[model samples]
Target: MARRRQAARAAPEPIRATSMWRVDQVFLTRKGQRVEVICSLVNDRSGLRNLSVIAPTEDPREAVRHAARFIAGKGNVSTARNARVRWTREQSTTLQDELVRDEQLEDDFQDEFEDMLAAVRDQMR
Candidate 1:
């Protein structure tokens, strides 16, 4: 009877598992005329972090404005007419992996306390 009760109290799988990355901060980077995206992240249970993807032709300032708009909660990124920066969950994970492999993220940025996506979002205004 005790064993059965204990089994019922066991934690779920999601609680046991560690995350790959948490999309925290997003700011644009420029390489001369080219534009790239630097997605700051918190790499769970591993080293290295950061994502850089070439998104040229997109004005860097415009990209920041779009991201800021989403973070500011002024518009929706999901609605058909709400087109902005878009990436799938799978793609986000892939970008996290790429950044980790390249050691692009800084240790300072890895600090979970400073890397809250919510904090960044709130500051978008």
Candidate 2:
């Protein structure tokens, strides 16, 4: 019983480094769905790279719109009107693979960021 309570009280983990992509833009359909999204990122503190979205859905455009609104509201960010790129299925697959590979790299930055956040939370406690 005590162990169960303790586990329940444990803090949630921080966002993983692999999930931290600097989003460049999000494109939506007129019906309000997230059709696609584009993200700009740096893998090794070097050149900028891009990620293309390839979510399987009935209506990609609508999906894109939904994603745009969700990200904007959650992160207090907005997508540029002119930056929306029409995504091909092949390109989307490639980008998805790239994102996976890039995230596989050692997550030093994420460790630092989470450590700082944990320190702050501990201080407040």
Candidate 3:
């Protein structure tokens, strides 16, 4: 009975599938003629450290994808562990909007923006 109890106690507990990092916000910003996607992450373990990703693009979907990829690629090596992306409906809308009416000037410089995105992608790699 003692040996059985000791063996049972030594058994490992099942791991829970919980995200250690949460995506706090996903927003867009205008930089010169290009639109950039920014993602804010919070470490669930301590909720003190944060991570941010900035991807240059005209499309919000691409921005989210880039951010996700960056997180998957870097999250493990960093202080973050098992991080997952989470955002509200309003934040999702931000990713869906390709062109904000208020940023009319940004609409005029499409080619330049694409070039900038390409350069940023290259640098990221």
Best by TM-score: 3
Which portions of model 3 show Cα errors greater than 4 Å?
1-19, 77-125
State, as a TM-score between 0 and 1, how close model 3 is to the true structure: 0.38
lDDT of 2 at 32: 30
Tens digit of per-residue lDDT, candidate 2, span 13-120: 775554333444332222233334444443332445554444345364434443443343333222222333344444445756433322211132233334444555
Let me know the TM-score candidate 2 reaches against the reference structure. 0.30
Q: What is the lDDT of residue 60 in candidate 3?
A: 48
lDDT of 1 by residue, 1-125 (tens): 98999889957656534444545555455555755555554545443455556654356554443433333242211111111233333434576643432112223223322334445556766
Computed on alpha carbons, the lDDT of every model, listed in order, comes to 0.42, 0.40, 0.46
lDDT-based ranking, best first?
Answer: 3, 1, 2
Q: Tens digit of lDDT per residue, candidate 3, span 1-125?
A: 98888977766766656545544444555455444544455654545434455567755456555655565454332322222233334434676543333232223222333444455557779
lDDT of 2: 0.40
Per-prediction TM-score:
0.31, 0.30, 0.38
